[model samples]
Target: MTGWLPVAPCTPDGCARHTGAVRAPLPAALLLLSGCALVLLGVACIPLVRLLGAGPRRRLTRCWARAVPQAFGVRVIVRPHLPDGAPDGVELVVANHISWLDIPLVASVLPGRMVAKREIRCWPLLGPLAARGGTLFIDRDRLRALPAAVRDIATTLRSGSRVVVFPEGSTWCGRGGGVFRPAVFQAAIDAGATVRPVRITYRTDPHGSGLAAGAVAFVGADPLAASLWRVVRAAGLTAHVDVLAPIPADGEDGRRALARRARAAVLGPGDLLQARQTAVASDRANRPAESVHH
Candidate 1:
């Protein structure tokens, strides 16, 4: 369905193909239906908390979000590579946000609460579900709230619920990597938990033709529902989620260092194809190196 869309100019440096936006009919209908289902599901689950428990209800919500892409006829590709024996305590997943689909994209693979801006928590149906699901809403403007937010995040992690944060603050086209807002990384530092970085890309190639940067991109001032509708209405959709190894909480290099490393991994090595290969190789190298005694 994505193939039917036209490509536009991508201002991001490394994005080679003209970016395509999603504004199709099929996706529009599916998004609406899926959203309605989500709302209805939440309403139904509200009463079942006694029977299902918060954990079960949360799990169901995650499952519903995971199924959204399919409802819109889009396939989600997730490659999550975690370090061996990563601590079971709370975790912070730092992923790049490309489009509104990112909410579902990140939520689908990562099973945990989210650290989103205050706005998402009030976004009609989703807002209600997210708040009820235990998502930690951060009021970025209120510096006084930082300590409490950190404590809350740490508590959630200690309780075994993961938190996904898009440090960039907002979503962008997947054409290039964006800077990780330093303030958001504080939670991971304060909580003494590992930070896992992830990269996301959406392509039109149904057969996985490397990446079709030209066929899909949602950016700037474009209303979320309208942009998403464009993608759903298109002919085909394929997306990839590359999860890099998690960084230790106590790095000699600070969170900023980890952020730099993560940005490189997501952006690749400048050349698109080369960057992909390099990322794969680097990820392989970062694995706890083994020794062969002579």
Candidate 2:
């Protein structure tokens, strides 16, 4: 079941030679099935929203995400060490980027509006769900447009919904957290929202048996279908979700300074209290459940 199923590999420019037709029909079918299931679930959620309201609906959304991981033959292992305090008005959460799949992956774990690249807004079925879920899309090439978008994000946070952003700006292969983009971090500072740092890692096991840290990683230009096939061909995957410390919405730190600290906290070593005094402790005033994790 395990062997180096090699293609000619990619050139330095990241283009694969495609010398051999890498058959991915099995993985493709699995992905297509998952997408269909998600679409049905989205439609089913319409009525549920009427019955349960936004609170329960969002909760259900997260629940659906959690269930899909295993149903899709994925596993999630979360180790959260969040900083203490409540964000003053809104919250801006920053996290590492890994794959396109991270969308549903994080969506299942956190109930919030996602900040995605603008192209995602045009995606087939996923686009509609993201838009309905209040996702904010940014066109990276358009710097002029970012200011207004940031303001909009600030407003959304002030209205009391968490906004999720991947500060890395781009996805990478492996467990590595790529270079952090500093622009969007300003929303957290501008809105005085707590900036929570999150790191996500995926461990793949070809044999479908292993611990969290022991699994293989699927990274870098590995097509989704191919990656899934590689994983299915392997054992199983144990995904590690680490919620690092949050930085305060209030501090003497400038935007770049704050971004640096946050990037370090999520990417580098551990520091628990830096996030506590600024955000988490203050948040206890908003929701008692803020302190509790599922």
Candidate 3:
């Protein structure tokens, strides 16, 4: 659990365990059956949702979003704090990236269009589904494409729709994440929207104990299939989504300042403490191995 580990093949006896972890992987059959059922249900409802208008489509999308995580045995807990006089117009939601699960976890509470990497737009069934759910894809590798992506996001916001963006640009271990990229904040500035910072942290307990659990992060070089399998097998996994007070992106406020404030809100005092604890634990665990090597 100190670092990323390879997933063991499933067997009748059960998947192999991390040497010092307390939980055992759940059976593969259970995950497969639940996954299949969820997929079939989603496919059957696609046509129905498509027939509806935008408002109804978004509502149904929220229902399905909530259902998908439950199918994987993960619960989404939302803590929304909105100050009085908060703007009711288009809202731009910015959050930390922890795992692929962050999508459904956030969607379950706040339904909106997502800004995702262009690669996700071609990922088999998921790609098509995401497009139908109103995801805006951006080619993060191409610097030239930034203006267009920003324009699209601004347009979506101007149309009275919510848009979610992970400014970190990539997933990371749940303990902490990379710096927030300020480019996406330009969209909020351009649209004169309200930016709401959301903090997403995973836990192994229903009541989060302020610890960021590693079991829920999709980090390192793990394949999608392996991460999905691990998620399905994990028990008592919970996602904590904290929606901080909204910040207005007036014309006067620079995008850099907006990005800094948003990032600080997401990585608040509580998160910093949890990160420190995780670093200390990791250091202690590595000491024995270092001594043996020496």
Candidate 4:
């Protein structure tokens, strides 16, 4: 039962790792205006995109998604874990939830149907656009609605379309992430779709650095405007979308086990060790004082 959506303990004050260097106020304002304009253009045209064929619409979506980040001065790098490159098949793309940028970051590389919370349907500009873009809405607060949602995802996957889901169900700071909720994995198993684990990490510099960019994180009650402004002002913001190996849809593996395997893949290649340390430390710091003593 998914009556209770998984929530991250991360808060902007406690976990957001902001960049030390920032763009000048003038340049940042320019980037912010450009980013907002691009987003508005994309959202306003969602309905009109239906005039084009499915293939063309998908390409446009990917292009727009990629352009938005660039307008905001955020560099994106997509890495393929396998030698063959990103797989072409019906897949359930599951990723570690981080910033709001995670959605477009994934779409730029692996365009597909997205599974999102139903509440998004009411968000101002982007909400209606998401609905028109063929997003699958899941009622995470309604336990009974989950079964039907899973069935719908399975049906879509069966129709040979890829589906992207943030199985963590909530946004976490890039320094850490919540466990991947197993409910969505059921849809992949039901549809016999390969599970593609993706790891999205944000850094202050494009070149690999130890500093995690919390400036991009959208967690807890942080206002969207504030997060967006921080992103546009940040200096040298970079996002890495690492496409981990694909996990087979083994009917024998229950959703829980399948979710574990997927999470493992996303955290593999030495990431899990660092992630475990960060997650544990973050969790401990965020824990209630009473619980910390206990």
Which candidate has the top score in TM-score?
4
Give the range where candidate 3 is weakest over 10 consecutive residues by summed lDDT: 285-294
Q: How does candidate 3 fare on TM-score? A: 0.78
For every model shown, what is its TM-score relative to the native structure? 0.72, 0.70, 0.78, 0.88
Q: At residue 150, what lDDT does model 2 achieve?
A: 75
User: All candidates: CA RMSD in angstroms?
Assistant: 10.4, 11.8, 9.1, 5.2
Give candidate 2 misplaced runs (Cα > 4 Å).
1-35, 43-51, 81-89, 205-234, 270-294
Could you give candidate 1's per-residue lDDT for residues 91-135 as a string of tens digits? 788776666667677666665677776866766666787777667
Estimate the lDDT of model 4: 0.75
Root-mean-square deviation of candidate 1: 10.4
Which structure among the candidates has the greatest lDDT? 4
Candidates ranked by TM-score: 4, 3, 1, 2
lDDT of each: 0.59, 0.55, 0.66, 0.75
- Kindly list the per-residue Cα lDDT of model 2 for residues 1-294, writing each as its tens digit: 001111111121342112222325577467557755865687557555647766666666766766665555566666662222212225677765555556666666565788876766776666777766667876554446666777877888878888887765545443234444555666777777898777666654433233332112233344444444444333345666776766896747776687778767775663334433333432333321100000
The clash numbers for all candidates, in the given order, read 16, 20, 0, 1
In angstroms, give how far residue 89 of model 1 lies from its true place: 4.8
Residue 154, candidate 2: Cα error in Å is 0.6
- The runs of at least 3 residues in candidate 4 whose Cα sits more than 4 Å from the true structure, single-residue gaps closed, are 1-3, 81-88, 273-294
Question: Which one wins by lDDT: 1 or 4?
Answer: 4
